[model samples]
Target: MHLPFWLTTALLFPVLLYQGKRARKHTPRLPEAQGSPCGQYGEGTPDIRFLVLGESTAAGVGASRHEQGLASQLALQLRERTGQTIAWHTFGVNGIRMGQLNQILASMELPQADVVLLSMGVNDTTGFTPRHRFRRQLLALREMLAPRYPGPICLLSVPPMHLFTALPSPLRQIMGWRARQLNRVYEQLARHAPGDFQYRSYPAITDVSLLASDGYHPSDKGYRAIAEVLACEDWFPDQPAP
Candidate 1:
């Protein structure tokens, strides 16, 4: 027996919505700036310099192009809001872990930056690296960056891992639970950080459509969501012209 077109569509709606919800559940939502307290930007021509250090997310893995990545979109937004020129540099690798990030920071002679945004941890959590060692290395890296960069040092919380929530049933539950645990660890580490460091908890981008086909990184919409959060918080005072 053949099914009516409308009936088939109607029947599929719930399943589709369920799948969408599940996809979103595993994805990270864009963070609200509610918990982040407002801070003053030092006077004079805001010497806005940004150094982004992290893994695939920072490198714009799921994005279609470089300009669509988190860094670029953030730069554009900052410029529009603060009306200050931003000098931004990005040091990202496809699958870098915390230890590797530390080593990279140590070996290279980086340009003096007023702001530093660290976007690591996801790979470390999902990758083979042990959590304890990863946390230690991250803390060390934080200490290292704090002293060197005079301005605000921010840590972008790991976006939700789609792999967990998007999986089938039992595996999804297990992965989702683990993702939350890791996120908590990240928050705790941020709280324990020394010096003028800020932790920005961005909501996990949940829309699967916002993710690239690989289902790992942010799509343009996801990146824009991140930029909106940063812009709302006035993270970058010296933004360049769009």
Candidate 2:
């Protein structure tokens, strides 16, 4: 944890608390996208298994169906690029902190995946998780995943909370500050992790229309835009799965 930052937050506690309550009361609660959470796209012999896990966005809260969400959109992009069938799955819970997500994963029998794209940070930021604890939780999650996933683990940087027009002034800035701190933790982990671990940031969405009606999660177009960027990076291995 950053001492100075936490001290500042402590000083602003009452105001932040009030703002948080107000925001919660006013923001519309949108359900996760309704559809099968797993699917296959394209056609080929050797296929790629892609998994998306983390928070609301990973759960497809902003789209009408899983096919229009990040997992499928990303699969489509990869299919177009590699001509290989992309089998994708998503596991995400709204308002889940890193520790909770880790616990849930420990209880599940997940399929082996060629690539893991994880979306995290917002809830942790808002929950005020200590920086060192966040680091430990992330490292633990990596260890748990490495055995099941023999491929790249891409950590998507926390979306810019400051950009969420739904939030009022100081609350938006404060949350954005916390988000940056967690993002730095992710960046540092990626920098030192083994070759398979990587980090990517969502492209800045300047247009308000790109966000869902809630102004928090990304709209379908936003998810597509993000998928385009992730695919263009070409982080997947060149060799076909055995």
lDDT (0 to 1) per candidate: 0.63, 0.86
Off by over 4 Å in 2: 44-46, 239-242
Using lDDT as the measure, the top candidate is: 2
lDDT of 1 by residue, 1-242 (tens): 11342355356556645764675687654321121111223345445766777887677666666566777677667766766665566667776788888888798887667778888766665453555676677668766876677554677876555354345553344345445555666677657753545777776777677766546567778888878877676564333333
Tell me, by TM-score, which candidate is best.
2
- List model 2 lDDT by residue over 48-158, tens digit each: 788999999898988888888999999888888877888899989988999999999998999668788899999999999988999899888888887888665789999
Task: Evaluate model 1: give its lDDT.
Answer: 0.63
Clashing pairs in 2: none
